[model samples]
Target: MDKMRVSGDRFVNERGEQVIFNGINLVEKDPANDMITPGGDRLYEQLATHGFNLIRFGIYWNKVEPAPGQIDMAYLGRVAAQIQLAARHELYVFLDMHQDLYAAKWGDGAPDWAVQDDGLAFNRSGLWSDSYFISPGLHHAQDHFWANDPASDGVGLTDHYLHAWQAIAKYFLEADNVIGFDLMNEPFPGSQAQEIVQAVLGYAGQRFQVTPDQLMAMWLDDTAKQKLLAQLNEGDTYSAVLQAMTPAVQAFETQTLNPFYEKMAAGLHDLLNGKALFLESSVFANIGVPSALTFTADNSLVYAPHAYDLVVDTNHFESYSTARLDHSLKVIRATQEKAGVPVVLGEWGAYFNQPETKAISEFHIQHVEANQWSQTYWSYYPEFFSSPTAAVLDRPYPQAINGDLRRYRYDPATQQFELAFKTLPGTSRIFVPHLATVELSQLAAQGMRADKRALPGGTGGVLFITADREQEVVLHLQIG
Candidate 1:
């Protein structure tokens, strides 16, 4: 459970081995259950058994500070207890200050005492995420938060948020396995989102030879919306729309989001010595818009973006397109290049129980592997192992590399895992799902010896390989 640090677009452990985290999200937005998701110990045990080494653990600001100036130790204790459970099972975790529409009343974020909605009506719309576009209450509250509006006790909201993070950090100062803090989850641009939407619609209107108003009408119609999403299945078509909205999106990110992050990170940077700050782009970026996010603090930072298609959070899961998702990754990659940070996709794969869930998960995993980016899938539940996605989650991966990883890929269909790296003096670890039947080829004859130890649950095990000679080497494993 050594600390993980950002090392030139890669996560490296205390032993200096490059680490790639393959994991799932553990989040609970419901307040009735005290904002804690019920998984107990078995949940983490299953995640570890499935070869997951990371958890994008969600913690709400509402739960952190239910009232301004009143930090909740009980809530922090509960969250810490879960992190301990994850650590007990050898899982690394990063805390995501999860929010949806900005406040606990709308989604799960700021407390009720902190929400300054200005008496605006909350218009519940088509989907849960639709409120981000249609609810004035949400926008108003978010605007105040970004503006650092004074709360009932007269302290600014953003200031309170920074304080909340510091409190959380102090609480977990000794929690060695708590790797980092995802500053915020899916940060929306308050009321400026309308301008971004207009930019997209304006570009789409001209492309379709219709007015923005007319396009809005079509978007509200279910069948027409599905057809519109289908049109975006073409990568070029989706890229064009994303490019059109880039200016507006960039303005909000560079002007508003970047400053907000700077302030928060500056306040918390001293507390996070070895832990990286996970930065998520604007919520609009989830659908493929490029971000202009940049951090000025000279601390470890990760380009943590959430990639999803327009079909997410809707009943139109069948309309999900890899072309669109591929384009989304393209945009996120551009942002990552600009930031020059390691990427850990904080959220993806929310296609719940779709007939294509397995295919969709596999497609996303392949791209993630190709890019060599770490990721935490959207979520985990008690019965998550029974889902089609669970199998895809257990695919082989390099848990930690002793040297620079040239490339790695796992073909589930063939049960073949291949890894190429510049060998160092120490052992490199790989997680093989079916370790007992795993057979090493080529490398075993090339002065490399693999020590396989079955993990606790016996479903998977780690292959620790040490090379006799220090040079570039490729190891292939047949795990079927």
Candidate 2:
């Protein structure tokens, strides 16, 4: 409604403290266009009430410019309206210009024009999975996203997309609560991991003539196998054993992902003028993970990674449990620590089979504590309501994103949200286990029975808190 505050890099307070910046994903819009409808307003309020502070949201290029050079005003209005609503609810925003395999025509639901079509036949190898699309030539091509492909829509296309982002940023960059802008969502340079790497590396000052991308013009190359081999010492047995991944890994870091960010960081600093968040990512869900990026500067650079254990990173092994996921978060935190950049998780969620969402919540909460970081959860779906967001966005609807508050967001197996609240300052119990769905009423009942105190917010007094095995269940009691 009114004006919002702008950001100038640093986000931590004078206290030098880091608190939980719980957020949700906000996606699920028209595949044919790039905008949020009035219908998103109600969800905005619902999200705020449920306690989400930061939101990682997206607007595919297809939606922004359905046809070349043609900007959509209605779509801009829709996006502007969404920002207003988020502002109303005090939700910090990260405007994401998203895409997948070039465009919706490639099957990701983005607008039609973003896809380059350019006679590059449908790889059809892997739709959303990793093993399908990646080829040696693609990996090689990914190694060089800038120079070799000046007009290459894959890399150059972002320049055009930035225009749309600038338009959106112009409207909300001044907003107090609006945080940053995500350049793209799950950027898949298609099977050209090597090519993507080559392009990026060349920009970073390395020169390569063969151009790995030209090698995988067909797409499905299965290069991760060789990429893994490169990780072994030159004379290592694995080189003889299964050297499928050595060069692939080499190109991924030196050429593709690194150079992509270098230009991106530069572009944002130049075009956006350090206005919004320059959040960086290693790869989409299925690509390899670099230890760190080349451009690890300050708060303006939100170093992020979409961490998924069984689903994306590795094959869907039997290790689809909470413990493995926790370990995965730790690894990501370690990478963030090494980079010396503010971190934000762009995407992380459980498979549909995980009956309860306790694991995912615990993973997030533990990560915040471990890194003392702030993050924008994977999705904030306003459409499919259920299909897009992670598993934790159900019942009691987690609407409040407070670092000082104790409330767990419950995303029902059926896509509803239930948020329950409890406190620990005034009650007898001090170690209230921080969890979701643990009974606040039981503690309230106990506090009432114990005559703990006469508090204003609730009848009972504050209590202590501790962790429960299941993340959502915190154990607590009343204050004296």
Candidate 3:
């Protein structure tokens, strides 16, 4: 129940109760801003005032290390400051090494040195393929990832990645303010099912001798990478190839994913035991198999599935559908059950309002609410900060604060607003974001339980309060 600890099982609060609530996703479009990259303390504090005590924070891997073996201390310092800010706000921080489509250019993942040239020269301005507006490098890596022969170092990249994480962990070893590391954000396993299977096989054969789909009860970080590398080539014989691939794949499953959890947890105890750690498995249900993994302990550990309706639907594997979300639950529930951790739907939302999505979302909300687990929508954003088209509330973000943007679009070219906002309403602070439509008080009525209240500002603002039953919060809205 202690909030300081998070294992392979549950996210228990200091009271030893499993924690659940609506939270914020904090990543800045403008790195120059004081929050996120430059000065995030203000941003953190702002989010706190708006009824958010949990935050999904993102950092690009390349920003930390533009070159292999070289880590930017200044960048790490910036991140540590953000971590401190979260603590000050009494918010839970899930520091995410986020990437989209993959590559330093795409958003943030591998350093420039990690770019793999697999002959994928296709370019895309805004399209979702290998080429890029800046360079073909980002596109090239994306191609290989989907082409199935990902040059993830298979060994080298993973090693550098782990080491980079270790360096970051060292700085925040004593910070009890943050929650856990989300490891890698979204990993694509492309079109090669056989290779995917083989990668796991190789992982098992090399590291814990795990059988395919077996629990890697004992995983050793020291030698796992080497074992994986040894098996990447397999052998001239196809059987040898299969055997090698098994351990490689299994090794990746356990090591690439879980070791991050293990290190963060172990470091907290050994180096900074008071801290908590949770694993955000690769992209949720990208494949039918969920990538969620576990650390040693079974308490306060959450295996998050970043689900999109379309991803779960798997037909377009392209369109988003909440109704199809159960497909994700079914694929991933097994792992979470085995690890004995709550299944955290790290991200979920509808691109458009669909009854099926609503039903599926309700099911998910009920599941999380029934068990008191927490899940967050895909994002939180403002319109004026960027192009109105890019706002979390404007187009695609599954906003929880306010909804029905078609009627809310303040302008024609832009449907979204600007800068994730929080305001101090009158006597009672009330918060209604531009996109959030879910009524927390109403949800409570439906048996979906969470610490929620209707803001005093009739439509938009929130009163911030600490975790105390005696705390009285009220907000007053100012109508235009």
Candidate 4:
């Protein structure tokens, strides 16, 4: 099959079937080393067995171009092997040029030569993301990249980055499963990040009854801010602070981040002519901020945003809150609707496997279904597949729709599934994992005929429904 293409508000395959990309992020992203784990081919098969149809594969720029203007074909060849494996297992691949804190020296991204920090001391906080606000080195490195500053070879940094992506595109141009390129992961705001943080802190203080001067003092004094951050890290909700900062951060995204995306889009225009370009807003956009990205790539763009509750990464799993989730979804959906593009939840679910986390995961999945949006979960580590949470992570979903999907729901407790869509002439397929028993006798749909068959290798079942005309069709699968 030809790779999926963006068609207005959905991804459509060559058959013109709307594809709901369902999968996880697969990356061995450690600061000290970057390598695809051995036996990764088997992992791809494992994902397929669990009914996942996509993998947001992480490809580090540092690994792809270890030196300035160097294109490491050998390293790319290794990554290509993984793509081929995914293709063989019938999975789509979204190549995510992943980064955190700008460089491997700090986290994982641009190589050492690209990190031109103007003599600022490198510092880190207890939380990994705190560096975005506090570390001068990260700010400098990000500033240089955004400015498209010259590297050691006098070639502009972004030019080198684009060339690296071009090479990747050329390498994978023939791979049918290589569906798209996630331009960058959580593109952070540099230089003015501190200002943005301060704006947020000041807003928080005003709402929380703390004085602006005191907030400034706490922001300046690392120990004081860290103490407050520790409270947040311990699951103290800061809804007022996060809500207040939304406009400031959204402004930064509009003023700064969108232009960067435009530059990248211009650079990759020719190379990614037929492929989708997955764009993300600032990491702050994950909470609840309207994205400021408005690009001209009307047909090939996807608003690939991440979402996590405020209590994310805390030791305790906060109970699922519909109001909180609804607010974030409303904000995110408004951004997608404004850009006039399909929304693919690029990443979510980074919590541990506690009872509350399980409920939160279910809530997130429910929203994804309710919104009729595609998503790839946060990750796929070996332990994650074996953990009890996997039961919730892996479930039955409509893989390919013959037409526009109206809504879908799956009750894990009862193993029941329901889907509604406007009918077209093609076959709509739903993945039915082992835990769910969907007999043809239990299937119900109007103006459609349903058939049940085992998936490849007999790992699971697939409910295939064929519709005859252009009308609304509803499918119901009761657990046997």
Candidate 5:
């Protein structure tokens, strides 16, 4: 397959065929481990067998540059070997410079030397994300990094980051099946951390009509923080709270996060010319907040955002609520449409062990299908292909289309798949995995006919169809 480029809310290949990316996030993540192993090759094969066509591969800064001014060729070679392995399986890769709370000392991404905390407390508040709200040391380190404050060696953090990115780009610029870089994982605003937390609390309180004194109590009292944490732990959506905080968070994204992205784009100008730059919004946007970031003229830009309900991490999937899901989809789609860029749901479905996991996964997949959007599920670790979640995650879909796709659906119970699209000169193909027999005799279309062919190595089959120019086509297939 040729390289993909963004074209008006869709991704098109060099041949102008619309391409939809369906894949998973693959990351060894630990710097002490090899970048790619024989196990990784097996995993890639499993992904291909499950009909995945791409991978949002994680590459950490701590691994690539263990120290200041040093580029680890061994690490780069491992990454390259993995890229080659992905190519062999016909899977596209987008390197994600993955990070959590900034450095390896706290979470991941930056090298230990780059962390510039001022001896502040690094306590955890039980929840992994609460550190962002409570850790002064984390806040200080992030603030310094964002401000590009000088390290012990006097080099600015952003400058070092730029160098790291440049080195990565130089290594992968001409590599096969390597799409581009996901500049940053989830950008957290660090300046005025306490004030920002207070502001959000105040906003949520006001929405709940709490008195000023009560709001102040929530901000100042540890008991109140515990109460709030209890609510979150109990699977409270806190919809009113999140809604109230949306505007303030969006403002932060506009004033702080977007500028950071702009800087990264400017720094990577030469290296990312024809490659897709996958951009993610602030962490708050995962809960239905609007994104104010836009890259209007940069056709290589892709709005790659993560999605999760507030109840995420509670081990019980929030019941499938269309109203809740629709709100998030609407907000994100509005942002993408406003920016005139295609969207790829970068990280979702971390609820692997949740009781409602399959339902939630199906809900997200349904939305992706309806929106004609591309997606990479949050992870492919510990290998859960035979788990209940796999029933929804591992399914068939149209991989490439010759023209605009109208809609598609797959009913797990019936083992029936349907797709609708407007026709072009080229052919359209659907990936059907784990099917011993596929019946396309009932396939219905206005101007297209379908034929079933065995996939490479006969792991599965693909239903190939050719459509007349300007004709609308629909296909149906049953698996037994």
Candidate 6:
């Protein structure tokens, strides 16, 4: 439960040990549940058993401030209770102010008082996200928010959001496990979204020798959707589309999103203390478009981007493409290099009840390990406890490294976990899930001593390792 801070493009604990956050998001957008994700000891205990060390906890503006100039202490108390529960299991928490179609009226984010639609019309679609493209009301609402329009109290909507963040940070300042705050979730470009979409369509249209209108119709058709997705899977095709959207994406990120983040950071600077600020790219950058977000090196800032396939929400496993996912992640990684900050992939794997996504999960997990980046999967569901994906999720990972981590990987096929790092002065810890039928086998160790101790619930055991000296250390172990 040590406080976390960015250390040269990595997250290090109070002890200065490298920390890798791996867990799931707990977002309960439905107001019917009182705006809190339902869980208790059993949930957090299970998460710990599965080797998860972080939770991107979701909070909503509507619940935090039901009315302008009012802070919802009661609602925050409920949220704090949950954070305390998670902390009991040694899980880190970061508050994510989540949104979808701009406001709670359409999705779950801004309060009703904060929405200014200019009386534009809104029509719901079968796929809730389609509203981003079809609803003029949603566009106008977001445009007003980005413009920082004055509310009934003569306060700007963005200012009100900053006020909400200040109150939340103050409430959780004492919660050691509550590490930081995610400024926003998947910020869309409001009316400018149309421009990006049109640009992409135009780029694709030229390739297919069709007009943008024709391509739009094709995108709307179910059968044509698969073909378009396949076409995009082609390396050159996707790259060109991303190239076409880059200009607009860069414009919005530089002109609007960058300033918004800076304003939020400035507003919260005095209160942040050791807590970090989680920054997310525009929704357009979620796929593969390179983010043009620029920031001076600051220890408190973390680049938290979300990656999703075009076929994410729908159950189209056959249409899933690893190439596309890899391409998108590579783009985000480039942005991280430019921003010179650590990355915690805020959202991924919205597989939702799909038992056949184990391969997809494995690919992503391996990619994350290879890059040495932190991640919290898209969401949590009861099915996660007993799904094909669960087996993949409950794998060995370094909880903390005493020094620079060169590499780490867990090959499920062989039940082997390997790690290489340059040794420092602290004891390194790795989470080894408890196996019902077999004990752990320390196949080899080059320059370190290893010990295993079981956790209270038999969910897993922490493999404690200490280096022999200040040099490169390698470990090879297996759980079978």
lDDT of candidates 1 onward, in order: 0.85, 0.46, 0.47, 0.77, 0.77, 0.86
Mind giving the per-residue lDDT tens digits that candidate 2 earns over 14-84? 22212234566666556443435335656765554444556776666666766656677777777777777
Q: Write the per-residue lDDT of candidate 5 for residues 1-480, one digit (tens) a residue.
A: 578778888888877888888988886655456644346667777778778898999988888888988999888988888888888888999999988888888888889989988989776755577677778888889889888898777899888898899899888888758877899988887755565566666766665578655765564455564455445332234555556566667777877777888888888889864788899998778867778786857688899988876455543355434455567777888887788888889988776655667776888888888888889887765746766566686678988888878889988889888888887886887888865576555654333567776645435666788765678766676765
Off by over 4 Å in 2: 1-10, 13-19, 32-38, 109-114, 125-127, 130-158, 189-247, 270-276, 284-288, 296-298, 312-319, 322-327, 350-357, 380-480
CA lDDT for candidate 2: 0.46
lDDT of 4 by residue, 1-480 (tens): 566899888888888888887778887785343457545667777778778888888999989999988889999988888888888888898899999888888888889999999989677866577667778878888888888899989998888898888888888877778888998999887877777677776777765578877876665555675565544432225556665677778777878788877877877777774788899988888876667778575697888899876545545354444555666777777777777788889988776556566776787888788777888888776577765557776778888888888888999898778888897886898888873465565554344678777656535767788877787877776654
Summarize candidate 3's per-residue lDDT along 1-480 as a digit string, tens digits.
124455344554454433444564666545456236443566555555444556777877777766767788898887777777677766677677777656654555666666675554534543242223234455456444333342334545555666677677677666665666666665543323245544644655545456744422112122443333333323223234334434434445564445545544554444434544456654424333445455455354557666554233222222333334455555566666677765556666523333334334445554544344556555555421232212222121112222111111122133322212221221111233431453445424432233424433223343221221322222222212
Clashes of 1: 0
Candidate 3 stretches greater than 4 Å from native: 1-3, 29-46, 118-155, 190-269, 282-295, 298-301, 311-320, 350-364, 383-480
What is the overall TM-score of model 6 with all chains considered together? 0.97
**TM-scores across all candidates?**
0.97, 0.62, 0.57, 0.91, 0.90, 0.97
Report the alpha-carbon TM-score of model 1 versus the true structure: 0.97
TM-score of 2: 0.62
Single out the weakest 10-residue window by summed lDDT for candidate 3: 403-412
**lDDT (Cα, 0-100) at 471 in candidate 6:** 82
Ranking 3 against 4 by lDDT, winner: 4
> Order of candidates by lDDT, top first?
6, 1, 4, 5, 3, 2
Candidate 3 similarity to native, TM-score: 0.57
Q: Lowest summed-lDDT stretch of 10 residues in model 5?
A: 228-237
Residue-pair clashes, model 4: 0
State the displacement of the C-alpha of residue 114, model 2, in Å, after optimal TM-score superposition: 5.3
